[model samples]
Target chain A: MFNEYLTHIPFYEELTQPQKDLLAQNLAEQKLSAGQIVSSDSTSCKGFVLVMEGQLSVSMISQDGREAELFTLTKKEMCIFSASCLFLPSTFHVQITALTDSRILVIPSPIIAKLRENNIHVELFAYKTMTARFANVMAATEEILFVPVEKRLAKYLAAAQSPIKITQEELARKLGTAREVISRLLSSLRREGIIKTQRGEIRVLDAKKLELKM
Target chain B: MFNEYLTHIPFYEELTQPQKDLLAQNLAEQKLSAGQIVSSDSTSCKGFVLVMEGQLSVSMISQDGREAELFTLTKKEMCIFSASCLFLPSTFHVQITALTDSRILVIPSPIIAKLRENNIHVELFAYKTMTARFANVMAATEEILFVPVEKRLAKYLAAAQSPIKITQEELARKLGTAREVISRLLSSLRREGIIKTQRGEIRVLDAKKLELKM
Candidate 1:
């Protein structure tokens, strides 16, 4: 289990055996059922978790009473508050909810902080990982404004390598839009000869043309 | 001149003597009139510049030919690069251009790398500064998508604590929109008693209503 977690996180793989052992000793296993609030708003985060089994959705409530999905984390993924946990801050900004039945290895940030103080490699590794993650989020934000929603949907499909096979409600949650809006856009794209979609899966038929829109 | 630069940056007050000396030794002064490209696309970045006078717009062009302004740097501010600048294989993705008559201090990245290798304190200081800047950018991104454009306009106004005196073009650049679009929105807001504009200035009349919308 420990090895599998390390394999997905390249930085963790760089740690010496003893270092990994230290992390492993503090790792506590927990299971979260689908739709469970793994971490809630206004709660002080005690530690970060490594996804061993399921998916976690990072989201926040908009003033309009809608939940906006910021991002999602699958197996081997992490969250922003993972580092925030060590910083002794109160009240997290985002609420993380388990999207599916999942198992996670919870690692307290205090322990990680200790490891950082003692291990040069761990500090560098963690810093690099956080820095890269921050850059990805920033790039995503740029995409949201510069790229139109339809193109974003197209690129999301291209990256996932499949059209998300979920109900309209679920799709809206993922895309951060209304189901009617998504259905309308999908129909428009299909008419434009950019994509072909069945019940749940979507395939890009004209990548050249579709990419031009992006 | 040094005092002006230090007054603009929050960290200048805390920097060690050696760090300040290193920066002083490495800085190369540059003059750029409004609309001049400081760093163009298709060119490799040698280093970043510290703005000592006027404003510089950091932006990227999308596939569809729209320009998205990431941020603007002015007196006492520096624009290094995204983390991808170091690790990504692509050439510079954004172009830095002068928005007004400006003077800037250019410091090559090689010098920073060399200093980092020999000075542990300097390395840590650099990492901390980058991390904090990344966090601010991340917050700005979240504010954009989740918060309405008017709310965003309000936050910017509040932070600026001034009338919307910045040109509509500059406002669009900051908000990542077309100047025409920003003009239409501002007109609507003005009609609604949210703000008043004359010439180049904008005065906020209802911060509460603005916050409510956000």
Candidate 2:
């Protein structure tokens, strides 16, 4: 049963039979409903979280209560934030929320520590994955600093399916801006016939024009 | 002689004598003058870099020539970016420069790979260090997105020693903004008697005032 999820992870292929067995024996399965908070604020580590199904949104909150989406983890992706807790007893300042009904696998941190100790491939896999996530976060930061919001919004829309099911306030939080700013931008886009916005959804009317914006 | 640098790395203490001998034998020492570029675009990875002396500045440059400092690698710190190159071939978008005359230890990637295969402690150390750097980069990203430039500049001034040697252009690049904007802000701060600027230097006259801005 666990093999289904394990098969999707590229790192599992490199593990020896005993190593794989150890992993299978130690992992605990968890089911979470949509909108559930997985971890938040000073939460200690139970283990490494691997999303077997559904999406999880990870966000950072400022001291003044402002929040910004860092990135999202989906199927077969492991939580890089959880790995940070393995080496040191540190507070995880970020919050994680399940975006849909999800099935997750929790590998005990000590088992992970032991696996990393014994298996070079596992260690390498973890290092490479964590570094990749770091690079992605850095790229997102570059986009926030260098790219215009219009372009960012357009890119977000272009990548997303039509009829995006997100509120202006939520979009604002994701983009690190105020709801009014997002509303004003959407209003301008609506005037240009690039998109149509309703109470809790946005539909791209002209993807070509949106691409131009990007 | 290499043992001096090895002693500074906390992970070195956990290695067995044979592991330490292997590291000392395979490691190479490199000397870099201040202002030297350590790594740049499309540079292939030869090894993991460990700073044994002085500091290294890592900054990301955007397509339109905007630059932002990611973070600095100081003594006993390994370059996580370099390690990222070992698993897969990818362009390094960030440039690393020696902040001062420096000495670094280069551990051949193959040798490090071999050690990791044999020594679990080495593997654990690499994983932990990479995760730590990832967290630091994430924090820097959060600061860039949430904090105002004025506050960032103020915080920088408060933390810096008097008579900052960097030019306005360099400072602007580090702050992820245009030089003219930084100049204008500095002029305003100068008029308020918070800082004094001359040629390519800035002297914080009132740290308390700067802290207030932060």
Candidate 3:
């Protein structure tokens, strides 16, 4: 399973045989059910997580018990937020949960850090992913603080190339708004003939009109 | 100036003399007045920024012309969002502006990359800062998404040990809320004897009450 997981990453071809062997020797497989919390004991987080199947959400839970999701990962996706423990080991600020029944391969910290030190491809892959995700998260912050929900919803719809396969709950989580707010906005969009909402999917009917909202 | 800047960071002692010389050789300095945009040509952003003096803010400007601040740096701070260009190397997303008359040291991308490759301390510094800032930005997102403005204001107030030397405009930017809202909240806190607001400073008078709000 670990070898199979290794092959799925973009850096596999760029890694040395010893690097591959190092990973294969250390990688552990974790199976999670839907809604399972994976941040306990900080064990799973003291390394890197490579998602092999299903979706996982990395989020922050505030003092009031409200969850603010950072990003989600599916197959072939890696979460370096897991390795955040080694950096700020005393504090556990990030949470990971199985959004669906999932399998993941976790490589302990020292090996990943070692690979990053010597392997150009691994380094690039890690930094590229880290910076991009961080920027996206900040962009999400800007959008929530500055952009109105209507414009945000419209822009989201306009940006989609096909019928958006999303639950209202997921959309609410993505937009950092409540499900009722998303339901109301979808109803409004439906009334305007701008989008067609079916079970767990939103199809844009008039992209031009949706763009206008943005 | 670059050598002077290097000594301020915790990792300076860990860097070799050659690493120090390389940084000093490549580092460039810039002087800017308050409100000058430093993110142009992406020139200032092509490397690492070491804040020698004054404060700089890294923010995201949305399509609608509103600013959402990501973080701010005072003395001894560095902004790596500039190096972000080397990775994405295409899109421009973050903006850095001088919030006060400021001087900063810049080390171009190639050299910084080289240093990070060989210097464990430099590598750790870069990743540590990147991950910490990214987490803070995501936490700010969580605050905006789930935290009420009043509670956020209270938390902000309670966290201050001395008189906060910030203007309403700066505080508004930091919290990603409207200046008027901060004004109103401050006034309410003042009226309730929970705090005292002077011309450009907020002095917390009742810590216990302020903590209660949080």
Compared with the true structure, what per-residue lDDT tens digits does model 2 show for residues B1-214? 7766787666678878888888888888899999887776656355678898999987876778665677898988877455555543343377777899999888887887887787766766666576666677777666765677788888888888899988987887687555655877899999999999999999999888888998
TM-score of each: 0.65, 0.69, 0.68
Instruction: Please write out the lDDT profile of model 1 over residues B1-214, one tens digit for every residue.
Output: 4555644544444556786677667767789899988875444355657788899887766666677676788787776652224433342256688999999877666666655566554344444455555566555555555665566766777677756578887896687445555777788878889888888788989877766665
Off by over 4 Å in 3: A8-22, A40-46, A88-92, A108-128, A155-174, A177-211, B1-23, B40-46, B88-92, B110-128, B155-211
- Of 1 and 2, which scores higher on DockQ? 2
Distance from true position, residue A187, model 3, in Å? 12
> How does candidate 3 fare on TM-score?
0.68
User: In order, what are the TM-scores of chain A for the candidates?
Assistant: 0.60, 0.68, 0.64
lDDT of 2 by residue, A1-214 (tens): 7877787656788878898889899989989999887876656355678898899988876777666777899988888566556543242257777899998888887888888777766776766676666667667776776676778888899999999999987897677555655777899999999999888999999999889988
How far is A173's C-alpha from truth in model 3 (Å)? Answer: 6.7
A175-198, model 3: which lDDT tens digit per residue? 756566688789988999989989
Off by over 4 Å in 2: A1-29, A88-92, A108-128, A145-214, B1-3, B6-26, B63-66, B87-92, B113-124, B148-150, B153-174, B177-213
Better of 2 and 3 by lDDT: 2
| lDDT value for model 2 | 0.76
Q: Give lDDT per model, in order.
A: 0.66, 0.76, 0.75
